[model samples]
Target: MRVTSLLVATGVLLCSAPAAVAGPAVRIHDVQGTTRVSPLVGQRVTGVPGVVTGVRGFGSARGFWFQDPEPDGDPRTSEGLFVFTGEQTPAVAVGDVVAVDGTVTEHYPTAPEETPETTANQSVTQLVDATWQVTGRGAVPAEVVGPDSVPEEHAPLDGNIDKRELEPQRFALDHYESREGMLLRVDDARVVGPTDAYRALWVTSKPGQHANSRGGTTYTGYADPNSGRLKVESLADGPFPAADVGDLLRGSTEGPLDYTSYGGYVLEATRLGEHQPGGLQPESSRPQGEDELAIATYNVENLAPGDDPAKLDRLAEGVVEHLASPDVVALEEVQDNSGPVDDGVVAADETLGELTDAIAAAGGPRYLWRQIDPQDGADGGQPGGNIRVAFLYNPARVSFVDRPGGDATTPVHPVERLGGVGLSASPGRIDPGNEAWRDSRKPLVGEFLFRGRTVLVVANHFGSKGGDQPLHGRFQPPERGSEVQREQQAQAVRAFVDEALAIDERARVVVLGDLNDHGFSPAVQRLTAGGALVPLADSLPPLERYSYVYEGNAQQLDHVLATPSLRADYDVVHVNAEFADQVSDHDPQVARFTVR
Candidate 1:
């Protein structure tokens, strides 16, 4: 015990010494001031010293962080710094008080080789080409920082970070950028989102967040309403714990701030505390009406044999438990039996059979399914994954109008039925030959008889907005080039709906699927033109209208629309999207309407 005490005293003595320096020392605060870029960037300096607080020796971000023992007392400046060694593998350890000789750089995480540019959430202040010698070893202090340390005001009113870059002290972007590479801590942070596949978690520091009627943060579409939510990025990947929405990360989470291509400004966490449930419950009571015919749209996210069986089982349970087994289900992204095998096998019987069996086992009626298999590699999703749209209907509640299935090249047209409107080909692909659907999921049109009424259901999965420029890119409110193709697909579906409406003025039509575009986009505009169809999402409160969450912002990408004649009400099911254990990335939407 005496020897141990002596060693502890000696270590503390060595670390407490004024970080022995060989040349002029520069304060970390002066280096990191109230600016998007570092003040002393691009200059080489010696005797820059601090105690190593953290070390990240993983991926492309191999570096160590240090913080001065005492801060400069300037709220607009940070006292911590990160020295990036790249592949050199610096011989340093955490808690080592060391002086570094290196070039100060404002490094952009996306384009690491190039000089820094003022792109939103792209840059980090760091020291590169560094050479450091540990003079002492002991514990280093990491000051706790949380939402209070950040700017109180929300982000810019226009929802663009570029405009607020000039005011680093006031704006959220500038404030977080100014504190880049700092050793920080967040206490009692609430996990607002699920832990994604990349081992990242989004948390909000504020208590009692405005959670939607369903779980997940509500998107008010106002200026930075969720400004307090920050991302927690794990430097050590793999074996990440799965967490649901509204969980609480209680205790001090210490780490160095980092900016990455994914999730922008993140804390590369080193020490994480315990997490507890945030009392988030899945939606239980489904839509109800005595004469209502319920319809639901769900993106199953490439379900196949090789997928996680537990997730698939939960998905089936959600359909029955949360959605109350809607009369008809418009399912998207149903993968082939062998999921991405690249063989010519395009059948999904095994996939659908298992899901149906699970649904039946979960107390739901046996659902009959219909879909046309797409040619291998024709539908764009995972490479070799031939995903397509399909429908699942409870035979007890609704009956499908059986007809011939259309091929990849066959185009189905709308026809005037004896009593109402129907498709020339049930389970037909609309405009399959159009370039707009070259590598995208084509729309599936089908006719259903519901409570003495003929209902036309169009299930579609349009082109995604993946190719669009990122919101944090050089472009503000980034351009969505993919909308053009989706617009064409929308027009085709709209034309078919118009033909159906022409045949019967009171045609009960429901268009539903993962539109892959926002409600206000041009594609939605074309889909709703002529007032023939109206998005049911508009009926929801703007704050609760979202069906998807990306970068902490809740927005709608999945939609359900109804013709004016259809007396329908919809609810965005909270079974997925907000939780990590979900079977799909999107929330399922269910609408109940009285038959015409």
Candidate 2:
């Protein structure tokens, strides 16, 4: 009793000192507990035993992950831990048995500028202000993560999932939380998302589920985030493959399960699998017929004159060959002459002139463009690069009805002329003064004549889903705060479309661009609320509906809608989103409509 009391007293004294001596051992599983957040968070845990699994010696987040060689029987509690060594290169090697003493912490990843303060991300359980000493050496035995090991259910049906007890045998997110910091393996993983600049690639453990024809998982709805999708990053900093969708990571890819702002629950692989090419190719759409009006929408991903010549060439190539030279193109993210430089320039004439010139140079038609310059720094996008939407029309196929009196704040109203509906000001802004356009790109409404039939086009670059909580956030049904602004933006566009329809029942109005929200979302629902327009993408084959790829799930963000009069036929050109070498993150969409 006396010896135990003296040792305990000595340990308390050492806890305050810089140095720590091993005293009274605790299990790593106990420190992890069974909840999404560590129960022992903010409490000092002494002598937690683990074998060093991996180390991240670079960047602001320098840390080492270790796992207990002998894991506890309960699958609910994790047997591994991460010791955050802020900015210091940790001197530790894999396979070393060590005893750690530190405060158990629940670390949440967030960027306050984008993500709202109310929303919460899944907290990573870690050991901070830690002191550790090597006790011995051991080999890291990784547990296999596959269809059998990973459950079908992604998370519980409904509720705040953070406080819920982990059910590794059932929920996929729970399974990942249960194995946090633990070494895991995936055999013959199928690539769903291409390898990004950060050397991270996404793969699916369970294949043939929610599978798209292009060897990727389609994120069709919010109900299922695709439980099979797993993110992998190489820890060795060695030569890793830049894989595309439908490729294969051939054998035994082993790593420690980690959580970060770099997409939740990543597998930092110490051993990367052999890269196997899947030979996936891009799909091209056939050109529109002589009578059909092909109007395509492409988000040229913040294109500026100063960008890489190859990128501009690739975009031009996609426009000319892949998209089959549409009569009218709605281009988004067209930055000013000085791309991303914070010099207060808002004009994008040089940018568009270069692109139109590029298309002409690429054996395409001589397309002319028209757009209004947005207020400097008022639109939300890359700082200083005032990104806005513009229209590019091939003068040979269609003629612009230049009504010329539109500015950033001037609203364009539909006026009746010659038994047809015409805009009060062609190439006008839609209700720009409304609060809906706050820090958002205002919709550009333009009037064009295709073979004597007038067509009204609304080029929109709505509020982005930038600040929404991630799908795997701490809160179930993660908060989509960005939707509120987008919904309002949708209503404003709908109101403008309604006005045109009210003036003339058959307005020939085409509301198209990067709507930023899914077709089933509330923002999109508001767009088609009164049956004023119908989404052309909805008419596509189930597997072929996607225009964007996010986290291995091929989804839709760009949309094309028209009044009931002009039923449109749409094709999502799969040139960029599926490939590792992409000109833009979004794929160009070509919608063909026949005018009376």
Candidate 3:
């Protein structure tokens, strides 16, 4: 779940109903006034009735979620109702006008801004606990209409509204924001794409699974909101109709609707139009056996697997498209664990086999991974999981060569001592005096024969927390000196590169990873010698050299640097910053290099 700034400041407090008898119901006016003033926390007040504005089945079986507008009439303040386990009550359809008597609770609000006003008013509000019992039901409400009827001014306001009314608008706006300026839609209508119809199926299987599960599957299709041409995977019994570039669809609004499958990869129906021409496909295709290949990298923000395998299946499509498409893909934030039980599964069985399978299904090649073993005795977030780096290569274009010390089957070297100090002895707050630090994976390096030439690829995910802080930096620095640890990681990579240079003068190297430091940092300078790796496009300006765009500023934290010889064959055709919504925090950076 995305955490907004406001939610972060006030810890989400939960108030439970009284045993058996249920808590007393309180008027909305009473709670609203107190919540606004002191924000009562963990208080169990009950009995408030409001129109059922919206209802949705949570991606998992966790239960249904409904939203109700403030009874006092302020749309800004809405209650997000979660009917969790044991509340297997009837499903609430959209617009089903029902009065519910239940507890008032606060979900984790995202972090609030550090401004003086917000910081000073960070008191949390508690909800009254009353067993929500549905009183009555009726046809979906009209005021809670679909996306087409929602005004732009009311888009971000969260209340229970007609699912039909809100969905299309939300879908359209999100798509518009995601695809701004890159492509245009025809007739501004909707049509189906390859993956749209199959979203429900995908979500049911993998709401938030890890990237390594092989059993995981994904579907791709599109939808035409205006024309009501919604094509989803299950909607059509088979393959979807072929669509070429520039096909225009008609008759759709921007709203959230479930497009089920019709026969032969067709959409059953569409409620709203997210954008024109339904779904998006790459306009340009890579020619088969082309002399050149495109290499890309992305962080795939929080691509970790949930405790359940089902959540992972839901997210397969986004992960596959974002991180697994390139000829040589490097991934950061990958987890490795060793123990009897992991995420409720056997340790030996928890590898990301599902993700690898999803990539192969998408016509991408298979992946091979290397990770550090967690220490025997360690205490932290989740035991047995280690964050490391891995690679997925197209076997047709690349072959692995065994180094004398590091064979094909051998694992990458473990930098037990970071920046010339042991993990326990490191001067950082996060891991200070932690002996199990070696168990934390550092960098994974390998030799790949790309286009008949050997290229050394090093993939790393550096320390993010525990960095030094500047007094006024927009984002607070890590308390443990994350800045220092990151520098040590950089030095480690450089050391690896220097070793490679000694092995073969003509050895081509490409350093691809999430370094945590931007392209302009002193650490990067120490590694690349002020653009010595040779900037791909001198004509493109420095601002465009970034792989991640955040807060209106472009930061080149994810990078692809090549040795001097390898630099001659490739030109930075273009880098993709578009997959921020579907896949990760960092967009994939793709560079096209002609085989010399």
Candidate 4:
């Protein structure tokens, strides 16, 4: 329950506004205004009457929310406002009716890690320099708004934030934006995602959604405008337990509407109802098969030397304890030894060595590693952090075939193996010079021998969706321009898979990595064209197929795709993605193949 310091000291100058004085009386709706930007912004107003709904003391923006007992009659304007009282506690409490005075301010509460280009300004509208006089104390009544009006339909298909801001009711984000600084409620809320480290919950009241075969929501190409999923921010200070996907928030959730840079519109909730677990567990059982050679793909999330030793320990334990120490592991985001220092150092042997030692400490067998270091700055990731894909094989269970011509720029081709085809370059890069891989992590191809069977593995870390617009941006659905690069990368990988299969029709080939796109995306379609190769995740139950959750949708970005001839059972380990206290941002995946 460690609250950040910056949020605790945000409004000193604003709260210090010239000693409280009698000011003009105004309605809550008047202060709310009818547009995205409040009309009364920067003006000091007083004598605003309302009932105290809740008090928040955790973060930097300490304050209490009040709701006008009487309606403003205009559906576009909200009848509630948050009066910033800073880190100090307020005299008023929930359920107390009072009259308050404060300066209207529109401010953006951006997190420190945000870049200048991505940091949105003036996103949240609030009341500052507040002073309130309590008149009476009584029970507060809750509003049941859901099923009928909790979430409005339609997001602009065209990518235009201006149109959304101009017409607040026309888009989903605009509709929520219009109700900024208001006490809102949602009834019959079902948890769409787990509670994160920030104690935020994502829920939706919509009955019909594009659910996976397992009843969990899937990322169906575009962000669904019709889905009623919304983020609920917990303002209280306490230990928040994780909720399962599809769990229910019994009764309702009530809070003041607030806008944040991460998830645009959210309800800073004063009250969240009971949680019912949907039988979701924190850890996934190891995949089983006697003749099976277990394989896993994990994006260690930029693991490098000289970083937090505890994080490296946890990641190693996750690989052994949670993933059951697969025979072969395809790891992404393996950074250089010096980490994010711009020293032009491009070796990762020490980085891999520490991880191997930790794995042995965690009771897992010592794993042999292989990878080719890319030219400095050639791989895209944290600047000075040259992240690349690597492999870790248990020498006891499998053997890495040593071949020639393995380097960063060399393209590995299929060669003859024992009754099958293996990679000509034992460990080499795939299409490094292709424009698609520029400033992105190139795919690492490795050849391994398991039980007299040759398994060709291509580990990849494709271009991310960083260039895509935000889901709540002006553009309704938000354009995914990064898909173009990923599609090209997929096509290149698919071509290699096709070549391997052509050399030997029964070639056992597995492609794994952080595709950085959904299973239903165009890139996936390109990779699995003609059913030559199939996503192993498709073989699992819909509810159990996801390896990543973004904006409340449980979907697979980390995939394990194998040729049609390979028999395998895939499991997206439920170890990291669901918990905020995770070693990595992604969930690792394990697939057991019956190769003999």
For candidate 1, the lDDT comes to 0.75
RMSD to true structure for each model, in Å:
5.4, 4.7, 14.5, 5.7
* Per-model TM-score versus the true fold: 0.86, 0.93, 0.44, 0.82
Candidate 1: which stretches are off by over 4 Å?
1-43, 69-78, 87-94, 110-121, 136-165, 207-210, 213-215, 222-225, 234-241, 287-290, 472-475
Q: Per-residue lDDT for 1-596 in model 3, tens only? A: 11111212343222233454445665444443322221333455555554333333333212333334334443323243333323232344444433444444333222332332322111122232233444455432122222333222212222211112223234332222111111111223212122322242111111111111111111110111121122222211334333211222233322122111121111122132232332334212233246655555556443454434443442344335433355666666555434223443212224456566666666556754433333332312234444445666667766654434442123343222222211111111122222322333455566556666655566666666332421111122213355565666666667656655655544566676676666556556667873435444333444345444322123456667765656433222122322212334454555555544
Q: Evaluate model 4: give its lDDT.
A: 0.77
Model 4 over residues 291-355: C-alpha lDDT tens digits? 78899999999899987999889988888988898999999999998999989999999999999
**Candidate 2's C-alpha lDDT?**
0.86
Point to the candidate with the largest lDDT: 2
Runs in model 3 deviating more than 4 A are 1-289, 301-324, 337-350, 366-384, 403-440, 465-480, 530-532, 535-540, 549-554, 568-581, 594-596
lDDT tens readout by residue for model 1, 1-596:
00011124334321121222334468777677655567677777677778887787765657788887777776667777887766444456777888776677776655535644444345667877666656776665666666565664544444444323345456565566656667778887777778898788887765445656544566554344465667897655445557777777788776887777676677878777577777766775465576889999999888887677796789888899988889899999898998878888889888888899899999998999988888888989887678889899999888999778577779887788787778888888888888889889999988899877789899999998876755444334455688899999999989888888888889888999999987777898898988899899989776688777786656788999989998777888876777776677898989999786
Which candidate, 1 or 4, would have the higher TM-score against the true structure?
1
Model 3 lowest lDDT segment of ten? 216-225
**Per-residue error at 411 for model 4, in Å?**
3.1
TM match of model 3 to true structure:
0.44
Which candidate leads in TM-score?
2
Deviation from native of the Cα of residue 107 in model 3, angstroms: 21
Q: What's the ranking of the predictions by lDDT, best on top?
A: 2, 4, 1, 3
